[model samples]
Target: MPKAKKKNRRKKYNYNVDRKKLNRAFRKRQAPRIKCSQIRHAWDRTKSVSQNLAEMGLAADPNKAVPIPKFMQPVMKMDIDGPEKKSKIVQKPYVLNELEYQASLPEKQSQTLSRDLIDYVQHMIQNHGENYKAMARDEKNYYQDTPKQIKSKINVYKRIYPEEYQAFCTSLQQEKMDKQ
Candidate 1:
């Protein structure tokens, strides 16, 4: 029997290899071409060193460029001649006498009792008679003063407005005198 003929398969085209070849061709064609005239006019090793330095502004004298004003320099320190003396700062103490201190403070004025307050106290004294403490606790009394406060306020009232208090004291003295 004759052998079957083998089939010849075509190879697949590779895109990467084709693309690289096209890029290489384009780069070579697009490369810049330098002219001989541009190179001749350009700075090269043929130019003198002094001419290159002058063109760079390095060859000019720095002193002749500009005069920096003398006033710009820092001021010198003043000459302090003799040996250094250490001077101390002294603070004075507050020395005030008792009278001077009292004079400096504000003065408190004694409060004067009103006629209505005097009358009220006289009425309470007449009704309660020596029982001021009970009158102080009574709700009917205008100022529900505590026993201690009531005593002090009565004493102050007697001193300030003494007419009623003096009359009460005189009557007591007269009763004692008559009994004697």
Candidate 2:
């Protein structure tokens, strides 16, 4: 049997260098160059460094460069006898009193549940006792919570208000005794 002839699939490569086209392409891709003299001329002695940079279309933080006034600059003091003498006075560290420290601190925020949620928990407990499944199926269970979720809420209520929970249990017991 005769073998089939394979077709040439190689791409044609250009070896010629076009200097004019290369230079034009490079110029188009390059950023606009700024001379040192241009920058010096654009800068204002009265204005801040950031302001000058911003006016020249450069990214600079407004607060980064703060210009100090001539009067605010510290003057070099010369001693007649020798070099500059340092001040002997030492500053004492400030100490806050207990009451003052307490007053300065932020007040604690309440993280307890809302009055409505607390009431709902109390209602559920009164109606269903320890039966979380019954609580979950209750008519007042508007959230349609699972038995596990109902039990968790009840546990939270008991943990948060131990005294109130104890009082509630005693009241239920008293009612049961009265019935008997």
Give the range of the ten consecutive residues with the poorest summed lDDT in model 1. 88-97
Candidate 1's TM-score reads: 0.31
- Candidate 1: Cα lDDT at 61: 52
Query: Which runs in model 2 stand beyond 4 Å of their true positions?
Result: 1-92, 95-109
Per candidate, the number of residue pairs that clash is: 0, 0
Regions of candidate 1 where Cα sits further than 4 Å from its true position: 1-111, 171-180
Model 2 lDDT tens row, 1-180: 766556455666666978789898898576344445456655566777565665555436644345455685568855588767453221211212333566699987455877888899999988889899899899999999999998899898888788888998899889889989
Model 2 vs. true fold: TM: 0.43
TM-score, each model? 0.31, 0.43
**Which lDDT values do the candidates have, in the order given?**
0.60, 0.72
Residue 171 C-alpha lDDT in model 2: 92
Clashes of 1: 0
> Which predicted model would earn the best lDDT?
2
